[model samples]
Target: MRVVLQRVSKASVTVDGAVVGEIGAGLLLLVGIGQEDEEKDLAWMADKVAGLRIFEDGDGKMNLSVEDVGGAVLSVSQFTLYGDCRKGRRPNFMAAARPEQASDLYDRFNALLRAKGLTVATGTFGAMMEVSLVNDGPVTLILDSPA
Candidate 1:
């Protein structure tokens, strides 16, 4: 499992020209499921994202978690994270999980985030989505589950 976490002042996802998921002041999560990902990966990733202290405190230190600020989350499935572009001009997606498995894991991940008591929004699984966000501090991080 891999997740590209972007701290954002606001974020939204549009599908078929209609906004599907939107949030204010939170993380814009682009999630990818690998062929080998399982239940443990989901658990670990959820915990990490929930407790990550990337948000700023009143004194200007990065000391607050999203939960502390009553923020929301907009999770989107993005299989392209597994794209392998090391060789050819075209990216290869061989490492990405198949749709059935990826969809299940994606839904589970969102559920785990919701269980953390944070407001979680989500884009449709496997949909071609357009995501927009105001990146807070432009803080972005990548997370990969333990192999």
Candidate 2:
């Protein structure tokens, strides 16, 4: 599993012109699942995202976790993250999990985030989505689960 976490002031996801998920004062998580990912991978990545101390604190230091600032999460499935572009001119997505497995893991990952007491919103698992966000600090980070 992997995720691209973008700190955001606000974010929303639209599918077929209908808004499906939205959040305020939080991170926009673009998630991807690999063939080797399992329950432990989901658990670990969720904890990492929730406990990441990227938010600023009282002294304006980046020392507060999302939990400390009372933030939400907008999780978006992003199989494209696994695209391998090392060869030729086209990106190969062979590392991405099959849709059936990937979808289940994606749902589980979101459920883990929600269980952490943060409001978690999500985009449709396999839909083409238009995601909009006001990137706070433009802070972005990439996280990967160890196999």
Candidate 3:
């Protein structure tokens, strides 16, 4: 499992000109499930995301987690995160999980976050989505589940 996390003032996902998911003052997660990912990966990633102290506190220090600030989450499925581009101009997506597996894992991952008491919104799995966000502090991080 891999995640591209971005702190955002607001974020939304649109599919076929209709808004499917949206959030405010929270984290935008571009999630990817690899072929090797399993339940443990989902658990670990959810725990980390829920506890990460990337939001700023009153003193202007990044010391608060999204949960602390009562923020929501906009989770988007993105298999491109696993694209391997070492060979040529074309990127290889062999490392990405098949749609069935990826969809199941992605759903479980979001459920895990929601179980942590965070409001989790999600894009349609396997759909072409347009995500828009105002990145707060331009703070972004890449996270990977432990092997």
Candidate 4:
């Protein structure tokens, strides 16, 4: 599993010109499921995302987790994170999980985040979504589950 996490002042997802999911002062997550990803991967990622100390504390130090700051999460399914573009003009998605498996894992991952006591908003799985965000501190990080 792979996730591109961006700290945002606000974020929202639009599908077919309609807002599907939105959040204020939170993290925008572009999540990808690999073919080999399983429950363990989901658990690991959820824990990491929920506890990552990227938000700044009172002293202006990066010491606060999203949970500590009372921020929500905007999780979006993005299989393109697994795209392999090493040798061709077109990106190859062979490493991405099939939709059925990916969808199941994606849902489970969000559920895990919610179980962590964090408010989680999500875009429609498999839908063409337009995501907008105001990146806080422009802080972004890429997280991958242990192999």
Give the TM-score of each candidate.
Answer: 0.98, 0.98, 0.99, 0.99
Best candidate per lDDT, number? 4
The clash count of every prediction, one per candidate, is 0, 0, 0, 0
Each model's lDDT comes to 0.95, 0.96, 0.97, 0.98
Model 2 C-alpha lDDT per residue in residues 4-123, reported as the tens digit of each score = 999999999999999999999999999999989999999999999999999999898899999989999999999999999999999999999999999999999999998999899999
lDDT of 3 by residue, 19-129 (tens): 999999999999999999999999999999999999989999999999999999999999999999999999999999999999999999999999999999999999999
In candidate 3, clashing pairs total: 0
What tens-digit string does per-residue lDDT give for candidate 4 at 48-77? Answer: 999999999999999999999999999999
Superposition TM-score, candidate 3 onto the true structure: 0.99
Q: List the residue pairs that clash in candidate 4.
A: none
Q: Residue 24, candidate 4: how far off, in angstroms?
A: 0.3
Deviation (Å) of 84 in candidate 1:
0.4
Look at candidate 2 and give me any clashing residue pairs: none
Candidate 3: residue 37 Cα off by (Å)? 0.2
Candidate 4 segments whose C-alpha is farther than 4 A from its true place: none
Task: Summarize candidate 1's per-residue lDDT along 1-147 as a digit string, tens digits.
Answer: 999999999999999999999999999999999999999999999999999999999999999999898899999999999999999799999999999999999999999999999899999898889999999998999999997
Please tell me which model should have the higher lDDT, number 1 or number 2: 2
